[model samples]
Target: MKEVLVLGAGYAGLKAVRNLQKEVGDNAHITLVDMNDYHYEATELHEVAAGSVDKNKITYPIKDVLNNKVKFIQDEVVKVDADKKTVELKNSGQLRYDYCVLALGFVSETFGIKGALDNALQMTDIDQAVAIHEHIVETMKKYRETQDKEYLNIVVCGAGFTGIELAGALVDERPKYAKLAGVDESEISITIVEAATKLLPMFSENLANYGVSLVKSLGVKIMTGCMIKEIQDGRVMYATQDNEELQAVPGKTIIWTTGVSGSPVMGESGFKERRGRVIVNDNLLDPDHDDLYIIGDVSALMDKATDRPYPTTAQIATRMGAYVGHAIAQRLKGEVPEPFSYNSLGTVASVGNTHAFGLVGKKEYKGFPASFVKKMIMNKSLADIGGAKELFAKGRFDLYH
Candidate 1:
């Protein structure tokens, strides 16, 4: 039997393992490795960070979705030697494989900014998301003792999709923070700072404006065209076009949601990469190594239309995973698989639990209707990867609320 190794248990790697088990049958021995044993919904991390949802609501055991045909290992990956078809694990030592899938997920990108890494709270994983919520609660308690206004301030750096969603979630949970601080909800302030003047470029101008307006209506202050210079322990320094002098936003809870890059293991593995992503071929294979397939955030597939790699998203990652699984099965059958292609069905940004905006195909949705569709989309993804068990247990069925 051929030995197959898949890294990371995110949307990409997990989906790949599920599909590979069914497609390849007894033809291959599949080994799946990840640092964590449970798979959490990456999209709902903001909710966790904002304390709007429990971490358990969005995570499920990895073994719950796996069959006996696939072996699962909970260990961190150290590096991948594609030329030798070997992977070095932190504790499990080296493992050789006939075929390997590199679907390692992303990490928060600090952009080499001073104090960004050491200062700001990140929402990349379960622990980090929970930590953000804990910090917010602690800050509220601190405000009660110290009576410092800075403790009531929350500053989010970035207006990108993740940043915007997080801001919305924070707004939804403002009342909780207010209660903790023994202050009115309005006393708690939430601010979002972005370098770009224009926000939500992914949506149509009208839709983006509607989304922004919805967030602003919640009393969140958004400062655009503010380039973040550095992150201090309790402040964020930025410079705006109107005034080149650095201005500081004082906040006890500073969130770093600027952006994310693929796993650093890509670079440690000696792959020719940019920003932790490998430029894979049409077949999603390393250009020089046929046995190696790189998918998810770690793989960059250029879009001929845009002359740039498609933006990394859970939607694209799942597609890449499913494709790789089927492609490998076909290869085992002595058949060549077709090149990968993508067509996005839609993109949605939720202002909160009850508000959202996005385009489905050529039609745009906003307000409560958009929120409903967003939940459905999330449920669909849960079913696709985790099946009926997870869908019923951890699914977002709160449509009317």
Candidate 2:
């Protein structure tokens, strides 16, 4: 029997494992590995960071999700030996494999900006979320003691999905937190710093304005056409529009949601990569190695229609998982699998607990209705992972809230 090794238990890795088990259970020994034993819903990480949702609600045990036929290993991946067909684990040493699927996920990209990595707090994983929450709470506590307004200013760097979500949650929660901490609500402020001309620049101008209006209504100040140059102690320096004049945006609590890159394991493994992502062929396999398949943020595949690289999202990873699983099964049967074709469903960006904007096909959705769509997509994601049980346990079913 062939040893099929899968690395990284994020949405992509987990989904691929489940599907691969279904296809190759009788033909292969499947071993799934992840750095963490628990699988967390990454899209909702901002909610966790802002103290809006418990991290437990979003994370589920990996064992509970995978079948008994698949072996699960909780360990860090040190490197991949492509020539030898082995995966190097940090603690458990090496494991040989006939076929290997890598979905190692992503890390924050500071673009080598000064003080961004050292100073700005990121919302990447559960631990980072908890850290951000503690930092915000401690900042609030400092405000209570020192009565310094600087402690009350929460600066969210970048106006991307994570940035907007973090800013909106702070806007929704900070007032209540201030009130509970015996500080005036007016003393707390949430500001979103975007380098773009507007928030969600990918959306249509009208829809983007709608999102902007919604956030502005929450008293969140948005500095558009702004580019941050450096982050200083309790201050962020930036330029407005397309100018050279630098301005300092101050806040002790700085949440960086700028961007993300592929896992470092790609480079360590000697895969031909750019920005931590391996360029894959049409079959989603490395050009030089057919036994190796790369997926999720670690694999950068270009879209044929848009001529741009597809955004790294959980939905795409799930689809890729199913494809790889089927591909491996076909290979085992001595048949070639079809090339990867991506059909985008839509995008739903949440702006606080009760507000959102979304696009499905050519139709646009906004406001509370869009929030409903967002929840539906999240629930569907849970079902895709482990069906009804996963949905009931970790799904976001509170649609009306």
Candidate 3:
């Protein structure tokens, strides 16, 4: 039997393993390695940070999810030597592979702003969410003791989906938190800062406006076209729209959601990059190598129709994984593999517990109907990856409340 090694147990990696097992039948051995032993729903991370959902709801044990079909190894991949077809692990020693799949995902992009890395909290993983939750609790405790309004201020660094969602969730939950901490609701402040001219730049103009209106109605401040220059210990320096001059805003909590770039593994692996992402061929395989393939956020797939890279979303990554899995199985059977093509179904973002905005096909939706659809999409994704039992155990079915 041939040995196939997969790196990262994210959406792409797990999907690839499933497809490979089905396509290759009993002739191949699949091994998956990841730094952490759990798979997390990266999209719902903001909800976890805002205390809307438990952190465990977004995470699942890798072994419990994959079972016997795929062998799960909990270890960090330190380096990959493509020339030798070997991967060096942090603890399990080196492993040689007949074929390799890279699905390492992405890392947070700091954009080199001063005090950004040190002062701002980021929503990246389950651990980060837990940290944010604890920080919020502590901040609230201090606010009650000191009666300082700045302690209640939260300045989000972006107006994109993640930033907007976090801001909206914070606004909805802030009142409850203030009551719990014995603070007045008027003391709480939540602001969203966007460097772009408008919010949700990827969504349609009407949908973006709707999202802004919904968030503002919930008392979240939306500051567009504001470029952040610095983030001091308890303040942020940014340029407002009226003038290009920089101004300072005091806030105890700063959340950075500007954007994300390709995983650091791509740079370490000696791959040529454009904006921290590796350039891959049409088949989602590295152009310079035949036996190695890249998927998820690490590889850039161009859309011939638009002359730009496909958006980095779970939908696209899952499709890429399935394609790569089948392609690899064909190669192992001494047959040619087809090239990879992406069909973007749509995009969706949640504003609050009962509000959302989505673009499916040519239709645009908003409010409760859109929120219901978005929740369904999230539940379906969980069910697809880990089945009904896992979804239920992870509280994915609790979207009704």
Compare the candidates by TM-score and give the number of the best one: 1
Predicted candidate 2 versus true structure: per-residue lDDT over 1-401, tens digit per residue: 98889899888888888888777748788999998998888988998898888889888888987776799988999999998999999999999999999999999989888999888998889999989988888888887788788888889999887888777778768766696456877678888888887567678999888888888898889887789999988888898765788899889899899989999999988888988998788889988998999998899888988787788998898898889988988888788899998888988888888899878888899999998888889999888876688899877777654
Q: Compose the digit string of candidate 3's lDDT tens values, residues 1-401.
A: 88899998788887888788778867778899999988998888898888888888788887776646688888988788889999999899999898999998877778899998898887777888778878887888888898887888888988878898898778768887798568777678888878888667678888888988988888888888789998888887898667777887788888889888877777887888765677789988888888888998888988899888987888888888888888999998999987887788788888768888889888898988888888887887787666677778874445556
By lDDT, rank the candidates, best first. Answer: 1, 2, 3
Off by over 4 Å in 3: 241-244
Best by lDDT: 1
The segments of candidate 2 whose C-alpha lies over 4 angstroms from its true place after superposition are 241-245
* TM-score of candidate 1 versus the correct structure, residues matched by position: 0.99
lDDT of each structure?
A: 0.93, 0.86, 0.83
Candidate 1 residue lDDT tens string, 19-119: 99889967889999999999989999999999989999999999999999999999999999998899999998999999899999999999999999999
Cα error, candidate 1, residue 310 (Å) = 0.4
Error of 2 at 306 (Å): 2.0
TM-score of each model, in listed order: 0.99, 0.96, 0.96
User: Per TM-score, what order, best first?
Assistant: 1, 2, 3
